[model samples]
Each structure stands twice: as structure tokens, then as C-alpha cells.
Target: MGERVQTVIVGAGVIGLAIARALAQAGREVIVLERHGLIGSEVSSRNSEVIHAGIYYATDWLKTRLCVAGRKKLYPYLESHGVAHRKIGKLIVACDQEQLAKLSGIMEGARVNGVDDLRLVSAEEVHEMEPHLACTGAILSPSTGIVDAHGLMLALRGDAEAAGAMIAFNAPLEGGRILDDGIALDVGGETPMSLVADEVVIAAGLGAQDAAAAIEGYPAEAVPPIHRIKGNYFALSGKSPFERLIYPVPVHGGLGIHATLDLSGRVKFGPDVDWDAEPAYDVDPARGEVFYEAVRSYWPGLPDGALAPDYAGVRPKLTARGEPARDFVIEGPETHGVAGLVGLFGIESPGLTSSLAVADHVAALLGYGKAQ
Candidate 1:
């Protein structure tokens, strides 16, 4: 028999670490298991580390709710913890006259989602905001921002550890069994071990479906299909052109290849969508042409060969191609009938922003609170 803990969280990503901190602070004996040698090496460290403003999702959606709530908590948490971040804001631009009308709809949706800080700007105001930009109109998301993701994760890890939470690296959950007393996990790492815990949180990003299926009793029908939507990035070679994040109207699968700046003031664009058969991070140089065209629609000043393939992050989407994007699916005992077990699926964009709030939701679902 392996050691028994009050809670075992699989995946030491930002969300997992956040949950670990929350549970440990709640006085629960918690352990975070990660497949990597370090925390946040996968989905947590990838993609645009933007602090979303809760503008793109539906009003009733979990993304909107958690993101709005999480963003509120994150800023203060970041400041108090000395995590590097910036509320630099963002602009969703309309390249043509036809697309200008879409800005109003987007603004309305954002307001409905409780992001009332968003403002629709005319072409003159758009130019005034971003001098080098080309757009008929734009929506300024005043609360949009970026963060030092690594620092945030490190702080979360430090807080959790301070609260008596243990993080076990290289610990990949191979399989598990649901039992009466608790859940059992077969953790594979430097040394394989069998561990049991009273509660389990499956916060695995792309591997969420596989992780859920490993548990023998989880409902198969309830496990939605997972797809890898890979978004590629390209870095700018010259001086940074924009101060704020610049975005085009969202496409069917993603928010379009938008301009995002790191804390260092370096400009990078992308995460243009591509469905991958498997997990791969190679960025083809030829794809730069496509980026050039897409970005040139709003940023015609883009110089030839100015964009270099930077990095790529894969989003674990719940639905297949051509289908509408699905909301974040977090199932607990009440829904999946798995007592003391919770599985988080399709945690993509705004996930970083909504991480803390999501942890609160998970804690509530697992009956971990002051009352408990």
C-alpha cells in the first residue's frame, strides 16, 4: 500500500497548482503530481499568456464566468505575490467596413458577459490608440493584459508548498481505481508508486480525456471527444510596433492571429489555427507567408520576412472541426457520479486568467471549504 493523502491533483499546471494552493490553504493534505520534471512545462507554459477580459465567450458560459471572476482575483494576487504582469489592454480591430458592424456585436456580447469596460472605437480613435494599425473600427478591451506565466506558476507552487502541499514531479498518472474510501492512482515517474487519496482532480490539459478514461468507473459516454487545435506563432524582428495587444475579429476556431506583447515589450503574432493529428510543436517556415497575408490585412506595414516562426501551442478543444466551440466542461460527482473526483476538460484560452476561480469552483464541488 502506498501513502494516502487527502487530495491528489493530477497535473501540476497553473490550474492544478492553484487548486493545490487553495486546498492546502483550506487545511487539506494535498499533493500535486506532474509528468514533467518541473511544474507548468506543458499547457501551462504554452501560448499567449494573456489575462483575458472575459469578452469573447458567451454570457452564460463557464469561460466568461470563471474568467471574469478569476481576472478580478488574479490582479490582486499577482501584485501581492510580486508576480510580473501588465494590464496593457487590447484592441479587436475591424479591417473592412463590413467587419466594422461585427465590433458592435462583439461589444454587446462582452457587455452581456459582464465586461462593461470594453469600448467601441471609430477608425480615428483606433488610429489614435494604435498609430500604425489599419482598421475601420475597433473594440478596446481596457482590462485585457499579459502576465509572466512562469512567475505566476512559481508563486502558486510556492504558496501551495508553504501551505503544506507537496508537488511530485515526473509523476504521470498511468491509471486509477475508484474505491469506497478514496481514489487510487498508479503514478509513473522516476519511481513508480501506487497512491490513494480521498479526492482526485484531473486537470490534465490535452490528456484530459485519456486521464478520465484511465479511471475505470468514469462514464464513457460523458467523456467528450478531444481534439488538438494547434496555433502557431511568429515573432517580429524589428522594433515593437504596437503598445497594446491588437486582434482581428475572431475566426471560426480561434481569435485569429493577433498581436500580443510579452512583458519585455516584444511583439509576437499568431496562434493561427491548424488541426494536428497528434501533439507536435514544429513550426514550418512556409507558414510565414500565410501569417504575412493574414496580418497584412490589418497591419499592412509588415515587412517581408519580418515574421519568424516563434512557438506553437495546442488547444484541447472539446468538439471536432466545423462544430461550434464548446464551453469548458468540469464534471464532479453530481454530474459524472464519481464521488470526490473532478475532471476538467477543454481548459484553453482564458484558462490562465480563470485559473484561481476555477480552483474555487473545484474546491466547492469537492466540498472543501471553511464550513467543511
Candidate 2:
């Protein structure tokens, strides 16, 4: 609103905020623009907040690399910043002989992704760890854990601000024009004004497609379309009995309705995947019917009516239903021919865990190393 910034980030989600912190730490003049009143109001806030263990993605892709690198970087950052989190571990349980047969391949995949410490535990050992869980076998991933996403975002915001980054909330970006010097942004408000930036990064998540269309000469069609995949969760009424996070074998669309504990030890289950044409955040209580059937598969004694709709999060999926899942898409000058512009799409699931690594990658893409 005042003057052009050296760098402008067009979203204040976790990904954007982390990049801001990284760039600002390098002493760049940074300004973060957020359409919402607060940071992380979209998909960043509405997620499982599970720090992934580098599984489920093909080894060569960005998701696999960033997730693996991010998992290694996240715990140290959390501890250094005093963010609340737990290394409470995760179990990929095999409920039947068919799923049991897939455990070896899953382990092999984890190994390929550099996810060490994955142990194939017997059903007897699983029962010893989680008394009520039913399973033929399970893979123990000690690195997988839960994080306080809000707290982590706060720390990143504080660090960025301390490094002289200015964050402007409620400053929705209307559109932009590519000028000879740089991109000029048309911002909305009571007194709308145009501001120029030497560089711009669009980490707008689900809104990325619209953001891409705003930039001249940028291929909107090449940017993969976003599909809203809604995942619904249910909170357990009483105190949690399980010590570790309990999960079932990975299903086609999502990780099965797994039991996850917050840092406070309150238990919740779910995130069963449902594809929708329009993105909606409504959490339907009726979905409890499907939840009971799915959850009871792992926790047989789940009391009737103990589970209630707690929350819902939508995933910005690059691939549609019945298609193979795709990797993270980070578009830069080489791909789009727009120097100093980077766009990120299909960043879901492991996004929180991969925040720092993703930021580093974006920084590299922006010619930060070359600038040095």
C-alpha cells in the first residue's frame, strides 16, 4: 500500500509464512500480503497437523524429498522455537492378510525414501503397544508425530517480523500486470493502490489457480486444476486410552481413519477422503454413520455415539479420483519463463512437515544462491 517491496509473498499460509521467514532471515526486504484477517485461515489451519514420515510418495519427487528433509528439519525447529509437539510415533496397521502382504513393500518404500527406524512389528507386539487395536502386523514409524500448527505459524511470523518482514493482513491482491521493471499489483481496499515488486511468490494453496491466471503470459491451463478432497474427523468423547497413534493400511484415496492424539493427549479419528466438485468446509454430522463402520474396524470397542464430528479439512489435490497421486508442483522461471515468480500447487498432507524444506527449495528457485 505504501511502496514497492523487494519481495512480496501473496499468501500468509504456513508455506508462505515459512518462505517469508527464510527470505527475511537473509536480510531481504520482505512484505507478506494476506487476503484474510489472520494467517493460515485456509488449508494450512484446517489439517491433521501430522508431521509425515516420508512414506506414500514416489522417491524421486518433491513430496518425497521435501517430506524426508522436512521431517529431519522440523523437530529441531520446533524445539528451538519452543513450539508444542509430541514425537508420539505412528503405526501403519494391516487389518487383513491382503493388507499384511503389502507391509513389506511399504517398508521398502520407506527405506528408499531414507525413512530409517521403520520396524515391522508383529500383531502381538502391536497389541502390547496399543491394547485395543486389531491388526495382523504393523510398521512403527517413530518419526511421525503431531504438531501445533498454529503455534508453529506464530513462531515463524514472529521470526519473520523480527527479521524486518512486514505482513499486511486483509490486503487482498486483486490482480497484477507485468511491467518492464517488475510486476505491479492491484490491491483492494477502501483506497486501492498499485504497488510493484522485484519478485513475487504465490503460495496461495487452493486459490493458486486463480492467482496464476492473474499473471500475464503465465499458462493457467498448464497449472494443474485443483480438486477439493474433503476429509472429516471425529473427536472421541472420553479420555483417550491409546498411547500411540493408531492407523490402518493406506487406502487408495487417503490414509484410513486413523486415531491421532493432540499434544494434550485428546484422541480423534478420521480424515476419510471424499471428492467434491466445489470446495466446501461444512462438517456433516451424518457422516458419523460411515465413521463408525470404518473406525470400528480398528477399534472394535469404540462406544456407540462416542465419536462426533469435530472438524473438516479440504485437500488441494492435483490428481483427480481414480488417478495416480502426483508430486508437489513448484513452478519457477525455467518452467514458466517468468523470472522471480514461483507458484506452488497440490501441497497437502505432508505440507506442514515439509514447510522449511519447501521454503529452501523455493528460495533456490528464486535465484537466491545465484544472487549471492
Candidate 3:
């Protein structure tokens, strides 16, 4: 017989932390199981850290709804909690007249997704804003910004802890069994243990599918196939040439390789979608050759030998290669026939920006519909 707990959230990444905070603040006894000693050690830490403007995803997607709503909630929380962030804004540039036509559609998509502040800027306006940029035109998203990812996680953890959520570090979800009333999870760590949870949320990002497949009686068919789509990045050696984030027209599989700035004003490029790459994080220097060419298409002044491989991240995509991207999967009992179990899948780029709202959605799935 395992000890019974009120709620258990697997994974302590940004989404899990945010969900834990919400449940705890709602007065639910929450326990978070983390496989790593440090929070956000995997997919959460290694990324561009840009706050998406809910522009790219479809108008009806959970990505768009939650990202727009989460961005609204996130800014105030960051300011109130003293987290480091900046609304430095972003530009979706068009390299040619054909690409310029795409910008209008992008702006319309953004408006449909509740991002109404985007402005279609002329090439002259683009150069005025970023002198080094040589785009034919661009869509300026003022609500887009950057945040300290680790800092935001710390704040979420703090709030959850203050509200009575306990996170067990190095506690991996080995497996679990579905019970009559709830679910019992087998967790492995320095010391293995089992806990029966009244509710379970699989917010394991990259490991979401594995986590879902492990639990006995969890619908195997309901667990969506995960594609390991990798993106590689490169950093600029010198001072940043742009004040704001720069982007190109949306490409297949991703929003194309673009320029992103961290909160410290350091510039980096890429996350060019590597469809056939292995599930590894090594950034091949040879890949920089592709980044140089892609960046020069919009920023022609990019000096030679300036790009150096920085890092890479893999997205847990639901769709296969060449298929259109899918929406966030917030599967609950209604959809899966498994009471008190919710699985979050395909949470990739806009995830950080959508954490808070996704948390609320997870809570709603568990019958706590109101956001606390």
C-alpha cells in the first residue's frame, strides 16, 4: 500500500512549476517529482528564452490562447516578484516582395490570436529600427520580449513552496498503476518509493510520451507520438547589432532561423530546424555555415567567421516530418477515460510564454476551473 497524496505533478520544468504553484495556491496539497537535482535542467534551460507573441500558432490552438493569456499574466507576475525581464519587442522580417506578402498574413494571424499590437513596418522603418537589418519589410510585435528563464522558475518554485507544494528532487517517475480512486506512481531516485496521488499531471516536456506510456492503464492510443525535432543555435562574438529580436518569414517546421537577444542584450541566431538530427545537444560548428547564409539573407552585413555554435534544443513535436504543426495536447479524463490524469504534450517554443495559462488549463482539467 502506498502513501496517499492530494496531488502530484511530474517534472519541475517551467510548466510543472507553474502548475504546482497554481494548485498549491488553490489550497491543494501538491507534490512535484523531479528527476534532476536542479529545476529545469533539460528542455527548459537550453533554448532562445524568447517570450512569444502568440503570432505563429493557429488562432484556435491552445498555444495561441494560452500564450496570449500567459504573456498577459506573466509580465505582471515578473514585475511583482522582482524577476528580470524586458519587453524589447521583436520583428518578423521579409527578405523579398514574396516574403513581404507573407508578413501581412502573419499580422492577420497575430490579430486573430489576440495579438493586436503588431504593426507592419516598411523596409525603411525596419532599417530605422535596426540599421543593420536589410529586410524588405517586417511585422513589429511590441508585446514580444525576453525573460530570465531560471529567474522565472525560481519565482514559481518560491510561490509554490510558500503555498505548501513540496518538490522531491531526483525523483523520477519509474512507472505507476491506476487505482480505483486515484493513481499510484512508482518513483525512482536515491531511495525508491511509491505514492498514490489523487491527481496526476504529466508535464514532462521532452519525456512526456515516455511518462505517459509508463503508467499502467493509461490509454496507449491517447498518448501521441513524439517527434524529436532538434534546433541548433549560434551566438555572435561581438556586441549586438540590433536592439530588438529579428525574425524571418515562417518556414516549414519552425519560425525559421532568426535573431534573438537575451535580457543582457547579447545577440544570438538560429534554432534552424534539424528534422533528421539525433536526440543530442551538441552544436556542430559546421552547422554555423547554414546559419551564416540564412542570417545574411536578412542581415547582409554579418561579418565572416562571426558565428560560433552555441547550443541546441529538441522539441517534442506531435506531428511527423512535413506535416503541419499541431496544437498543445492537454489530454484529460474526458478525452482519455482516465480520471484524475492529464498529460501535456507537444509543448515546445511558446511553452515558456504559455506556462501560466497552461497551468490554469491543467487545473481546470482537474476540476479547479478558476485561476487562483
Candidate 4:
């Protein structure tokens, strides 16, 4: 007979750890299952670790709501937990006159989403703020910042462990079946075991769909398709030209190849979206050629050979290329017709920022609080 547990959180990424912490703090006996031996080896630590200001998403969308709510909780949590972070702000620049109207439109949308701190700046004002930036106009998002992603994940893991939550590393959720009493999960890896959990949360980033399908009886039609949108990064060799993060107006699939800094003040630009990418991380040097063109649109002072292929990350997008963007799908029992089961699909971008709030919502779905 397999062991019985109160809850099993699939994937020990930021979202899973956050959920484990919340549920454990709520006094639920929780277990977090991770395929990797260490925590947060995938989506949690990849890409720009920016604390978004809830500006880019739709006004009434879950992305905006959770991001806004999560950002509010995250700053205080980071401070009290002693995590390294910076409120260094961000700029959404319009590099040419043609992009100015769109810049203002983004500002208006942001204001509608309760991003009250956004300020419109003229070319002269932007130059004063970022000397290396050449823009016709810009939106100064003072609340946009960056955090130590690894530190944040560790903090979440520590909190979950402190609350009596156990994490099983190298424990992948292979396959399972829905039972009347509980969901029986087959744990795969070395020393494989079986676990019948009263509740399960599929927060497995790119593998979320497969995890959900493994549980026999989860609606096949409900599982959203996963698109591996790979975004490549290029690290700068010389001193960082800008002080704060600099963003171009968003492209179709991503926030563009914006300049983001780590806590050490090192600049890395990237994540130019690759629609037809496999689950790989190799950064081709030839890709740097495209980065040079994209980056020089705003910072024309970029010197040749300054960029070196750094790393790449793939986001589990719900939409295919050319389709309109979809909202974050935190599917609970009420929607999926599976009791005590919640599957999170397409939880990209603002996902790290919204981790805590998403945890709260997951708890609510499991009968803890109101889902808001």
C-alpha cells in the first residue's frame, strides 16, 4: 500500500514551494515533489527576475490581479525574510516617434490596471534619467524592480520546511489515477514509491500538462497546450550603460529583449522569443547578431563584441505563435470537475512575482480561504 498524505504539490519551483508553504502554514500536512534533486532548477530561476508593476497585462485579467496583489505581499515578505532585492525601477521606452502613441496607450492600460505610479516622460526627461537611452518618450515605472530569484526560492523552501512541509527531490509524478477517497500518484525516480494525496497541485512549469494527464480522469480537453517559447540572453562585457532596467514596448510573444540587472548590477539582455524552440538551453553565437540589432535600437552606444551568449530559458506558453495571449489558468476542481485537484497552466512571466498570491488562491481552492 502507498503512503497517504494530506497534500502533494508537484514541482518544487517557486509556485510549488509557495503553495506548500501556504498550505503547510494553514496546518495541512504537505509534500512537495521535485524531479530535480535541487529546488528551482527550471522556470523559477530562469529569465528576467523582475518584480513587475502590473502594467503589461489586461486590467481584469488574473495576470494583473495576482501580480498586483503578489507584488504588494512580496516586497514586505522579502524585507522581513532578509532576501536581497532592489526597487531600482524600469523604463518602457519608445525609440522613435512612431512608438510614442503606443507608449501612451500602454501607460493608459497600466493606469487602468491600478498601476498608479507610472509617469510619462518626454525625450529630454528620459535622457536625463538614462543618458545612454535614446527614446522619443517613455513610461517610468518606479515600482518595477528585480529580486534574487534563487534567494527567493530558497526563502520559500525554508518557509515551507519550517511549516512542516516535506520536499521529495528526484521524485517525479509519473502517473496516477483518481480514486474516490484520494488521488493515487505513482512517484518515479530512484526508490520509487506510491502516494495517495487528498489534494494535488500541478505546478510543474513546462511539464504541467503531462503531470495533469498522468492523473487518469482529468479532462483531456481542459489541459491547455504547452508552447516552448525559448528566450535567449546575452551578457554584456563592458560596464552596464544604464542604471535601471530598460524595456522596449512589448512584442507579440514577450516583453522584448530588455536590459535587466542582477543584484550585482551586471547587465544581461534577452529572452528574444523563439517560437519553434525545443526543450534546450544552448545559446548560439550567431543569435548575438540579432541581439545587437534589437538592443542598439535604444542604446546605440553598444560596442561591437560586447555581447556574449549567456543563457536561455523556455517559457511554457499557453498560446501558439500568432494567437492572442491567454490569461494564467489556475484550474481548480470547480472548473476541471476533479475534486481536490488544481492544475496551473501557462503560469509564465509575472508568475514569480505572483507566487505567494497564487499560493493563497490555491489554498482557497482547497477550502482554506476565498479565491480572490
C-alpha RMSD in Å of predicted model 1 compared with the true structure: 1.6
- Residue-level error in angstroms, candidate 4, position 158: 0.8
- The TM-score, computed over Cα atoms with residue i paired to residue i, of candidate 1 is 0.97
- TM-score of model 3 vs. true structure: 0.98
- What is the TM-score ranking, best to worst? 4, 3, 1, 2
lDDT of 3 by residue, 1-372 (tens): 688999999999999999999999989999999999989988889888988888988987777899999999999999999999999999889999999888888888888888899998898988888999998888899999899999999999999999999999999999998999999999999988889999999999999999988899999989889999889999999999999999889898888899999987888897898988997999989888899899999989999988888989988888888897898888989999989999999988889999999999889988988532
- Considering TM-score, which of the candidate structures 1 and 3 is the better prediction for this target? 3
Each model's lDDT = 0.89, 0.87, 0.91, 0.92
TM-score of each: 0.97, 0.96, 0.98, 0.99
Q: What is the Cα root-mean-square deviation between model 3 and the actual structure?
A: 1.2
Off by more than 4 A, model 4: none
Q: Which residue pairs collide in model 2, if any?
A: none
The digit string of per-residue lDDT tens for model 4 on 248-292 reads 989999999999999998999988998876769899899898999
**Among all windows of ten consecutive residues in candidate 4, which has the lowest summed lDDT?**
270-279
Model 2, span 146-264: residue lDDT tens: 99999999999999999999888888888887777787887786657677888888898878887878877666755888887888889999999788888888887788888999988
RMSD of 2: 1.9
Query: Which of 1 and 3 is the better model by lDDT?
Result: 3
lDDT per residue as tens, model 1, 58-113: 88888789999999999999999999999999999999988898888898898898
Alpha carbon lDDT at 38, candidate 1: 90
